[model samples]
Target: MNKIVAIMAGSVWKVLVQPGDLVEEGRDVIILESMKMEIPITADFSGTVKEVKVNEGDFVNEEELLIEME
Candidate 1:
């Protein structure tokens, strides 16, 4: 399993991929808004998305798991 994690503490602005979606390394999987700036969270490994761990508007902390792929 591959885990995609948040880089900063912020509110989840958008989820770009869904379950069963094919993802490549470095592809943006989620967008986070913090201090009025948009931060894109990308996949660290290429795989098919297995689960989305958070929803839009949810607050997340640094190092939090955002997506799970396999």
Candidate 2:
């Protein structure tokens, strides 16, 4: 199984992937905004995106699970 981890502490600005989307390692799956800057959440492994755990504009902490893969 693969997991996508949040890159920073921020509000989720957008979700770039949906369930069943094929994601490559180091791909940006979500965008977050913090301190007026945008950060991209990236996948650590290549796999099909199994789930998106957060919605647009949702607040997320550092290291949160943004997506699951398998």
Candidate 3:
């Protein structure tokens, strides 16, 4: 499994993919809000989305796992 982790502490602003969805490397999967700014999280590798570990509005710490892919 490949993990997509948060780059900074923030609240999940949006989830752009669901489990079973096909994704390409560098595709934006989640958007996070921090310091009143929006940050996008991208897939690290092309694969099927195995799981989304965080939900919208959920707060996450830097380096926290946000999504899994396989």
Among these predictions, the greatest lDDT belongs to: 3
Q: Is candidate 2 or candidate 3 better by lDDT?
A: 3
lDDT of 3 by residue, 1-70 (tens): 8999999999999999999999999899999999999999988799999999999999999999999899
**Model 1, global lDDT:** 0.94
> Which stretches of candidate 3 lie above 4 Å from their native place?
none
lDDT of each: 0.94, 0.87, 0.95
Candidate 1 regions with alpha-carbon error over 4 angstroms: none
Each prediction's number of clashing residue pairs: 0, 0, 0
Residues 1-70 of candidate 1: C-alpha lDDT, one tens digit per residue: 8888899999999999999999988889999999999999988789999999999999999999998899
Instruction: Estimate candidate 3's alpha-carbon lDDT, on a 0 to 1 scale.
Output: 0.95
lDDT of 2 by residue, 1-70 (tens): 6677777789999899999998888888899999999987777778998989999999988878888899
Q: Report lDDT (Cα) of residue 15, candidate 2.
A: 96
Error of 1 at 20 (Å): 0.2
Cα-based TM-score, every candidate: 0.96, 0.91, 0.97
Best by TM-score: 3
